[model samples]
Target: MSISPIAEPFYADARPIGPDGRRIGVLLSHGFTGCPASMVPWGRHLAGLGYAVAVPRLPGHGTSWQELNKCRWADWYGEIQRAFDKLTANCDQVVVGGLSMGGGLALRLAADRGRDVAGIVLVNPAVHTERKDVLALPVLQHVIPSLPGIANDIKKPGVEEHGYDRTPLKAARSMLAGWKQVRADLPKVTSPLLMFRSAEDHVVDPSSGQIILTSVSSRDLTERILEDSFHVATLDNDAPMIFEESAEFVRRVTGP
Candidate 1:
């Protein structure tokens, strides 16, 4: 039997900066149920531009959604934290970024790391949901192991994200608790922020973006409305724009 796409090698190892001599580090995380494939293009773009970039696949991800249910928020957070530590240990400066649930994780990292984080970038970061079913997750998690998948919310045609097709309920509950903590500590995010909101995102609600802006204390924040893409903007129509702009953001924040 062939390995599932999610189980394939989806992570990108750190690429050393040679020609650019930027010595800037960037850590990019993928969303819930999403594998590193979603962030690979973005990370590769940065690496190609001569920045040391690592796109770490979260624990319990890129394997099976059922396995994801076995993991908690701490497991996921620890994975990214390790990646960030590796980046900052060698590079002169470091920036963190993510998409959707990964965005929340990145924000939490910024809060815990404090001034160590030079900047953050979020593409359609999701925090809270208006769905009443969310309130029932505590009970439903015991009743059901998963829900319909929310992955691959790309606007472009015939594009697949290769994430878990089923959304794990147990993992989602843990992630929700994480988002609560992140929202409470939003004021601690003092790093420069570059946020992109899709004008027509299918996965994350538009209100989620507003919640981030209203909550974060970063005065050096930049927001762009992606009119041509969806929630997975990194792989959508404006993907190149995200890649180039984020590379620029890291360069500008870290100084050449």
Candidate 2:
């Protein structure tokens, strides 16, 4: 008997930049259960600057919540590693960035790859939980699964006030496990990092940002607080700043 596929259909769309072929590729990873749709604009902006950009849809994303529930951190990290490898092959240098859980993955990649990665840009990375219920759980994660739900905290411009819109409990549990793993491995990240935090973020704990700054070994670390946005600062008032800062950081790291 033939076996069935384990993953859902997903895509990685690439956009090129510049005339001299001096492209600096950037790999963008989206938040948990979020598709590339959220990071498309950032990729486009980078592409406009003569850099190749790749945004990969993580495993179990852009599909039903059930698929997300079946995914683990390693699965998601594998997809990101593939995307990073592809970018490295196409460009002279590569930078990695992500939102929320994706940020955790980015940090993990930068840590593992060492100097191969040019830099990192993180927006509202979830390093620790302020949620008492989630932090209290021990073996309950393996016993019960949670459904995906709307994000209660978002400050994107002109977007409706909505939450994640789906709350896959099992997926969240797995992601939490991944976050813990990444947290343990933070000291390994040596690349220059730019961490952006939202002052009004209601979802992720504000201290998570500080933890990242203190944990990474990157001497060129820069931290910015977005006062007008929430957790999804990439699409909010701070987006332009993010775009500018990210481009600037990549330029600084890769040289003129």
The top-ranked prediction according to lDDT is: 1
User: How much lDDT does each candidate structure score?
Assistant: 0.85, 0.77
Instruction: Residues 25-116, candidate 2: write the lDDT tens digits.
Output: 88888888666766777777877777778888787776666677788889999999998888888778888999988899999898889999
TM-score of every model versus the real structure: 0.93, 0.87
What TM-score should be assigned to candidate 1? 0.93
- Lowest summed-lDDT stretch of 10 residues in model 2? 1-10
Q: Where in model 2 is the C-alpha error above 4 Å?
A: 1-21, 136-144, 147-152, 160-164
